[model samples]
Target: MRDRAEITIVGAGPAGLTCAIGLALAGKKVVVREWHGDVGHRFHDDLQGLENWTDPVDVLDELAAIGIAARFDHHGVSEGVVFDGQAKPHRVRGKRPLFYLLRRGNAIGSLDRALLDQAVKAGVEVRFNDRVTETAGDMILAAGPRRADIIAAGRVFDTDMEDGAWLAIGSELAPKGYAYLLTHNGRGTVASCMFSGFRDQASHVAATLAFFERHAGLRMQNPRPFGGFGNIRLPRTAMQGECPVVGEHAGFQDALAGFGLRYAVRSGRLAAESLINSTSYTDAWRRALQPGLRTGVVNRFLFNAAGQSGLDWLIERLARNEAGDTLAQAYRPSLPKRVLFPLAHHRFRAPLIDPSCNHENCDCVWCEHGDHSAAIAGA
Candidate 1:
């Protein structure tokens, strides 16, 4: 931190950057340190979503409430197709956007670049290609995931096809999770997000591609393979010593579908508010995010316990309530989900790992500290 800065934040990802922007805007001099050469170093041009349907309010309005403007290039996906185990396609539409599509990278038009621009404009000093081992003083840690609880085999390619979003469900396609194909303009991305069988991902990826081709009349050119992972956990605390940890570093991710951008932004804002108001970050975030996170755990647990036929039945039911408002209610926490939470929490939360090298994927802090980075698009 500089002589005038009141706080230092580690990592330049969304959470840390959001916090820096907030603190800086509040007239508190803030500095952000990033280990990578620039923001979004862990990602390439991979597509990610800012889920909009889980909350009762419109996601855009919700974001405005927290002071994060939608300044990045994004497409609102209000309609899409979902395929069940038997390869039967169902049309799913939302009254509002189900999720906003975003590009994750350092390039212009990406979400990372948008936040980086906002932070710089707010007078937040950002030091790239920097690292600090110590976790002390008025510091916040937003250093991404520590492990891969779910890995994805993804590809980005050029296509002549029209804009569309498609999701497929089946063991052959994506073990316990799901496979997705999203396209806008002329660019396309395909990924099989799997929770198990990491070693046999090649076959899973191939099968997913073939399935989409057969069903959606997909086409591609200059296809490049990239990969990523989701680190989902309901943390017991969001503090490291006296500092607050935000985003994936604190395991603040959606337990059901691995949608995390919403959680990341909200947690970052709460962390900044706590610092600004001299309140407790842990208490603040838990009140805001805990219910939905616990609901996600229960949802995933039920989805897991459901067999093939049960999954088919679920697909039928979900398709009927595809609109954002109708679907959001289904995800709302309930007594049944609450009753199952203790068990789900126990079963779903991943164990913490020591920061010891486990693979030679990348030399970033995450990989050096034992988290394996997958080969991503353009990596």
Candidate 2:
């Protein structure tokens, strides 16, 4: 690693790698460090692990801006089917690609090679197998759950899937997310899905297998099962300083939906721009993700009001069928002030609540002073 660089990014995931590529493209000296020695190693063994790996066109555009684009041999389905345990299954179709499933290794390998190649071409230094023990200056932390320690060390603390295998039947078995069984170059099939916090993940897995067996009317003695988890974080305040945090580190994930790759790419570009142009990081972040944040607030409200069943109903009805066109329309850049004001109301209420209600002698001035004479004396 260079002793001193204009920027040092930790974690070589999509977010960090994208940022590094963007910054280097802008002619800034950059160094990136990853704890893992080899890029895309963890995913090498599980090539066909992801289900519904849809590539949003906007994400592709952003990647292209940084000189990296996803290469997939298969076309993605725009329609997704949802089984709600009642009535006929629902199908959602839209203009956007619903979700695309690919081998994790392929996605990671393409991105890793693209990022490193661009960084080297642009004269950016990269360090692998080097864990960041300490951070200072303009450092970006995109370590995801691994950053739990860094979060704990800070003072301001506003805290905070599986499926299987038959093509049609297995898809029905999984809830909310997509299920896929893909054979890589005619080798073997890898089946998986996104769980969406279902109460019984194992049961969902079993149900998917059963659906495959019943629908396909065929069964191997023992079908292989593989599963994994994806996540999105709530909107959170900026950390201790002026340096901007991007991607999962800054809580840009949609808590309602686990789709974060688009957001990650957008946020990474926004951060790079902020650094290069010397713009206010907070302003840039807000401008970058305002729509998603608004949507997230609405999602949280609905989830709290109706719970999973309600969410399932809405998602099945709205999100799945029109593909994600309804969502795309809802998330348009020109969101009505009337619609957004309510979401702002929801997001701002926590700071407005009186802490004294939860604990006596709260520091808030609204709390009544117990003794008038003592209060006057102290004043």
Best by lDDT: 1
TM-score on alpha carbons, each prediction: 0.91, 0.66
Deviation of model 1 at 8, angstroms: 0.8
Model 2 weakest 10-residue run by lDDT:
149-158
- Give the per-residue lDDT of model 2 (tens digit) for 296-340: 556544444564466467656664446465666544444463475
Which residue pairs in model 1 clash with each other?
Answer: 226-376, 226-377, 227-375, 227-376
Q: Tell me the lDDT of model 1 at 116.
A: 94
Name the runs in model 1 displaced over 4 angstroms. 1-4, 349-379
* Superposition error at 256 for model 2 (Å): 1.8
Give residue 234's error in model 1 in angstroms.
Answer: 1.3
* Tens-digit per-residue lDDT, 249-332, candidate 1: 887887778888888888889898988888888899889998998998888887788878898887777678756766687679
Task: Report every candidate's CA lDDT.
Answer: 0.80, 0.49
Clashing pairs in 2: 47-103, 52-100, 53-100, 54-100, 92-320, 92-321, 93-321, 93-322, 93-323, 161-195
